[model samples]
Target chain A: MSDHHKETFISKYVFSLDHKMIAKQFLITGMFMGIIGMLMSIMFRLQLSNPGESFAVLEWFLGSKWAPGGILDPNMYLSLVTMHGTILVFWVLTAGLTGTFANFLIPLQIGARDMASGFMNMLSYWFFFAATIILLCSLFVETGPASAGWTIYPPLSALPQAIPGSGLGQDLWLVSIALFIVSSLLGGLNYIVTILNLRTKGMSMSRLPLTMWAILITAILGVLSFPVLLAAALLLIFDRSFGTSFYLSDIIIGGEALHHTGGSPVLFEHLFWFLGHPEVYIILLPSLGIVSEVMSVNTRKPIFGYKAMVGAMLAIAFLSFIVWGHHMFITGMDPFLGSVFTFTTLLIAIPSAVKVFNYLATLWKGSIRFTPAMLFTIGFVSTFITGGLTGLILGDSALDINVHDTYFVVGHFHIVMGLSAIYGMFSGVYHWFPKMYGRMMNKKLGYLHFWVTFIAAYGVFFPMHFLGLAGLPRRYYTNSAFPMFDNLTDINSIITFFAIVGGLVQLVFVFNFFYSIFKGTKASENPWESNTLEWTTPVERIHGNWPGEIPTVHRWPYDYSKPGADKDFVMQTEPLKEGKTEH
Target chain B: MSTSKNNTSKQLLWIAMAGIFMFFAGLTSAVIVRSAEHGWDSIDMPIWFWYSTAAIILSSLLLIIAKWQVKKGNSPSIYVLGALALGLFFGYCQVKGWDQLTAMGMYFVGEGSNPSSSFLYVITFAHLVHVIGGLVALIITSVKSLQSKYTKDNYLGIELVSIYWHFLDVLWVYLFVFLLYSVK
Candidate 1:
């Protein structure tokens, strides 16, 4: 720990093993990836909205190759959409949200000196950085990026000649993803080990903050699921490179019969969804956990049903594994299997409902404060409820048959998993910025960012349900291809407008984040006056979290507004009186 | 940070091993499901795989002996070297088994290959990669053992490596049985 102060610039800022520095790295990189992913979405949305209209902005950004004479090439349209999903899901949400907060808060909140293994932590970030470089580099390839949609289903992804983007671009996508998986596994292993092994003396599991519990479960989900995705990616790589027929089958492409036979694309789908379904939870649970913490802190109440909230998270983690089949109900899977998936998928809603009720109960009749973090957290609950309710419609096998791959399904997931998680991430960022940077973010800008983002997020995704019910399929380059979708044109434009507004609002967050790091008002050590152990530490970042002996926790993290307390909030380190009982 | 932290690391190692187990479980499940689908071709088990399995088991046995020797406060260099030698031999046998499969018209790719053979190569090769990782650990342990780093009072590194080695051995056996039964 003493050697930490003598760290050189390269060691301290670049290739650093300190968990706090690594967390900042993850945050910055994730923000950059988010920008790219968002811009890609805007590009495609512009195409979807105007159809035949040419935008010089597209040509200016994408160049003549992708947006020739301003109209986005159809292939490039698919490429943008595919890259958008891939970047957002894996790079931004999974890595950015989980990687950033897990690295920052896990050590601070748990009262540990640093991660269990700092060297492996450094390796994790470098691997992720390499993956990010490779993925972004793929966009510069001559044939464009992998355009077979983010799912990259087999026949399209397997054959290089199947699509122009499938050539070298898909290979890079696989390689980049393989590296990303390695990074994620290393990071997940570190998180699990640190959480389980590195907790200070009194930080018992039940007494832990919901954020720590959420991160622990999120790490477990990543550990169990990411490898399955790796297996799927490896087989896909073999099929592409070595002519293995793992995911390839009988197909005559161009004019010749391919050597591939006997491989089932369904197998790829199975392996993918095994990781994929859990992936939604992986992205989501952390945000839910962060919201729980923020909400409890803001409302000045002990979190409602603390035990039940933990139970629901556990139930959700367990149920996430079995419900992968729900995504494949329309792939001609067995009806019995579909029924099983439906039962499991719908069962997940029970725990989810319990969690929502717990949040509302926590907030009910409390001295509520609408900090920026609280605003985003409330927005998270709203979006989570709306998105989760729609999942019931998509989870049913019979109903899914009618709306599979439509905007309805898109709307359900985007709101539930995508926007909600982003909101959760924002809440965490606003809440923890002081801890990370020792400065406060601009509250007015945060509020402005949250309001615009929340309203426009719903404005963007809400009407897509109607478009889906109208039988509008996703991934279409232009809706004007058929007159049946003519009615969707105006709705598409409206969605696009709202999406652009939502995307622009994030710039406010970016400005506030970076600006506050250097110029904002200096934050007090316990600015929020919250009860977490992280607030017990000094504002100045150090190698070992505390300068001296670590504090031993005597109570749960959510002890806000306890009866007969000296203050409204009591820190975790506060010892109980002789007659007092632990909460 | 403390002597108790060693126990936690060991626990973390086991949790990681469980994750790796699930990874292999996923690949093996794919093997089962893909076999049930059309265009299946089964190949006979290579004799070298049996040899590889025996070699890995022997290596695990030697590691157990090494652990016992360390407990008795004796230098375990001989047992450590023996286990390392056997681990390398197991890797050799696996490569030879692949060669045998290649000779028997079972290729991982190209016109001659089937999905079953491809899966066989994949599962075996993937296990081999882990085996190589174990071998690296074994080599380091051997070096440290020869230098008399382990005694009755402290052998956590050796213990951890042995646990991982045994896991690798058991994982290979599970994969072998899985492929053997599913190939038919």
Candidate 2:
């Protein structure tokens, strides 16, 4: 095939090795998966709101067999909750958010043409796609999806007869997670090598954008952490299929003694949470980095304390590894280790506080654009703050005991990980929509998307704090078993109503995402007016990022509103002005 | 740029080699931890396994010599023979190791002995499985040497294969020492 013809639809769109196309694929798939996860949460919310009410909606969607006469089955509720959390957290957040942005931005922002291994980059997405399919397949299993919690804690997960969902659905869950971990490993390896080896001429590590720093450290965490999860999955597989008890012992299944003689479930928790804790930041720091990039540009001010911002990020990443025990304080862990974990966990707040302060400080007394991208950045910082402060509450060993499995924990994490990351995803879509699609998203719909989502998200989660304070436990199919929980039904109903609206508000954003791709206003070449190198390239993305010899970097990416600069911002590849510090 | 290109490729191969090494190291750590738990089982070390370990060490020597012959611009007929002998030696050692485990009543994918022993066999066998890929590379490197694709200044291809082969040798030694000291 001629070079021109060789670049046909199959090569360019489907099997294309360009990182940008791959990133687009990740974004689109993540949105699709995110909708599924969000819709499940809304469905569960409805059930929680009106327990013992008609199961008509679920039955209509899940079929009469699943709903069982318009009443949501307890097993189905647990299954949906498990799969919902699984998809949003792992499938959407880690792979979709981190994988896409890391692939696209790492090479571009770091000044490489493409990933270190473009073929492997393509394989990484396909593997993630396959894993997503396997996870979706669990929803169709006859016995139902994995109901053993998202953590898949054993004894519950290990015994075949522990719950009906454990029969085939838990098996599928393990297989899906194992596959996802492999996909993550492959992707992580490429990110590490590309950033380490493929930087553009003159783009040193210190001069790199904070986004690159976040991705680099996050990739390192994935590399060091994911294998432990693979190990955990393999052991669980051995227990499930091969009858080896690496993670189970002394459990009676259906009142019969299990063959598993001597194993520790705590070991599995240790391994799972080793990957699990870093995973929270793995989903978080990249979004934080994006907000940093967007905020500085929109404000047209040099990011306040660039060094301190990067330092806080590094501090957060370093501290993320040790706080796994906070998740397990109520898992009956040794009380002494709780202090160790609580201290590390709460210490995370200091750096996190520094980041939030830096963002607000950047916005302080500066020219700030309320563009949808900027709006989402502000939304992220807002949610990040509201969500992050309560983390200190749950981060405390004593306070966590009161609210461990309560909706407080749910509200805290959802605000931080859920809303914060999704806002990050949206901010990127609006900020780089011009670059990615060569068109601008409709600002009217974009703002509407921002306001509705912002309000509905708070409206949904804020009541959750009340329910938590009212001592409502999470993962309960119906809390009617306890008479004391009856008073909180009003709060559950209010939150559920808000959750449905929140779920629906995302439709506006989704419509904008697709509609804007082909039909929105034509974007200026540098729509966000940022100093990042990506804007220096052609609007029409090509296989090699630049058309000629690579552009050389001459300044830092966050150079906004510097003294004696002709423009408020400076392009990374521009020659330095006469007499000034580079930054 | 061209020379560094090949070295970068060599560096990539090194990273991949390190990746494979990490898998084995994790497996060994699992083995140590799993066996220390309750209901532990210990099995006698197989006798022929010692001989296989010795044979693999000797094969590393032959691989080095084979690479050296290609470097010296000599006809590699002797090196080819030595490499073939070493490849066969390594494969033979792997089978004998399995057989010796069988003779000692340890089995992978079977009921006899604890799963810990099965894990030992699996980890070692898995490492050997990856070594087969390396062995194939050595064969291709031997053949490429015959075609004069490498010279003293541009011998990164041969050098990389030899380095990976040596790593496998060292990795196997580490596994052996670990199994020897930790299992009993």
Candidate 3:
């Protein structure tokens, strides 16, 4: 509105106030980091499966320090694993997933002109970019990236000489994390304020889409939890730089006694897990919400229980905070308290069960249209169920003692957080690709990508469950080192085979992504005959979303197959009478 | 919606402020709990901290008076200068308190002594760091007032800055009293 039309390149892309442009920036950045994180995993998997084997490409990539004569060094292996976890969790999953979708959808779906504070929104993206730069710079440091692990456990992280990565790498890791926390806080504040204050005339809280609900609650979780991580990181920085003992004690760095005393690493574990476990849910809930919207529209039916779905999301979020102790059950905590944590963790299954059943019920006996987005939604539900069943096993204290650091834990999270959330991301991209690009993605190519990814994801992670059950520990660089793991060698190799295929299948997505951007078939305004308000906007991207006036919400987002509606699905802006509004 | 944007923006600003307050709140909790633990040794605190608390409280009153003077077109520079002096005095008081602890032979990460003294130092130092940020904001407001950038009709910046300043003023007093009365 204020002479934004003739902006320069830097103002247009780098520091754009346009929400869609901001979303595009986040998407591209996230994809770049995702490629990095995924490639790191593949490299590690090669080491895990082959065990001491290397290629010329490996040497060319690593140089002499990490791969001497094409052989993988142990410290480099650990550092790569650490960096993989760091990039995927912070930059890719949290920032990429929430950052991209929240920027695009918050203003559009809520029918506002833009976010509540445009300056803050732009600041959030720039802070995230700065954090990404700091993290990448730390990799070029002489000591390598943080190798104390992504959690950066103390005693090792507290004392400088405990490991090579703890020297400069750990310091850089904390700095990156601190910057990232600031970025998330800024974005979270904007999201919450916009949702609370800037909804259009008739968009009641209950009438909002599931995506808005997830974003709002997820922002709340970010607001309350990220600051705690900031506090922990600050204390850790003090321990590292300023000589505080908040989480350091009984230490000997280079065989010299540390000046620290009476500090408990368990306290650090408590603080870290306080943010850590809820962070897992924070990364997944957006995907789950996206799946709901996609599924309802694709199935040509209303979501089975709209109020119940919102309730489940809220319940999951609240339970997420109180159950952070699940991650600390094996960290020398009281066994009695483990029972309490296990109880709360298992109680989460109730709301999760409600969501699962609601999805199934909505898909029951409906004229289901299996679009690219629909395929991803179904993939999410399947993987969520498979991953969730294992969570029950891990949540039990007696069982957890055996599987705490086993490959079983890896399998559980990859299926849930890794595969399921990735599916959610893909579903969103496919669903909104038309709205975003004014074009349609190739349906045949999308189906191919989905099936290969879905089958291969399960093929890759499911065998790790059997390996964990066979008493194999995780984070071991080589499986052949222990004769006890010899039988599991075949299983690990099989998983790698699937993983390589799955990783390669992503190339199809890469091709589709670039090809569709410029050459895909042009689409109509509402390409997918869905009932959400986003489809009602123009096909081409507009500066502030709608053409002139914002739309007024009249019903809940899912209004498919109503008794007297003209079409199978009805737009949210279509006014309905009082008694007819009940689902 | 336009009608309530101001209120909502203020609410959001408070939410951000609440995050900052809760961060410090967690630190205070850690300090209190650590002192109650075994092996904590108490250190001698300065008398100047109590005097600084009183100074900050007086500054809060002066800040309120300046807010009133904005509408009345009254001479508020004296109160503004008074609040700045008190805030500086508070910072100087903290530095002197650190010296007092040093003179008493307490050290951060000290060898073979109670760690409670170190906790005291860290708590005070962390709070002082944040207080310095608040002081800088107040200083900017003072500069803008001197240049006549604010008036009764458009003093939202002054109002918000003073509100934050007063919040920090009361926060420091509470921490001072809590530390003196109950710490160690």
Candidate maximizing TM-score: 1
Q: TM-score for every candidate vs. truth?
A: 0.99, 0.92, 0.94
Candidate 1 vs. truth: CA RMSD? Answer: 1.1
DockQ of each: 0.72, 0.28, 0.43
Q: What lDDT tens digits, residue by residue, belong to model 2 across residues B1-184? A: 2754565566566656655665565566666656767766776666656776776788678767766776776655466556656766777877887888887787654356465676677667777786788788877877777787776656766677778877888888888878877667
Candidate 1 local lDDT, A242-339, one digit each (tens): 89999988899778999898999999999999999999999999998999999988999999999999999999999999999988998889999899
Model 3 segments beyond 4 Å from truth? A1-4, A253-255, A577-583, B1-3, B25-38, B64-82, B110-115, B144-154, B173-183
Q: Candidate 3's error at A198, in angstroms?
A: 1.0
Clashes of each: 0, 1, 0
Interface root-mean-square deviation (Å) of every model: 1.2, 3.1, 2.3
Query: Best-fitting candidate, measured by lDDT?
Result: 1
Task: Report RMSD (Å) for each prediction in the order shown.
Answer: 1.1, 3.0, 2.6
What's the TM-score, to 2 decimals, of chain B in model 3? 0.87
Which residue runs does candidate 1 get wrong by more than 4 Å? A2-4
Tens digit per residue, CA lDDT, model 3, A517-542: 89999989887787777788888676
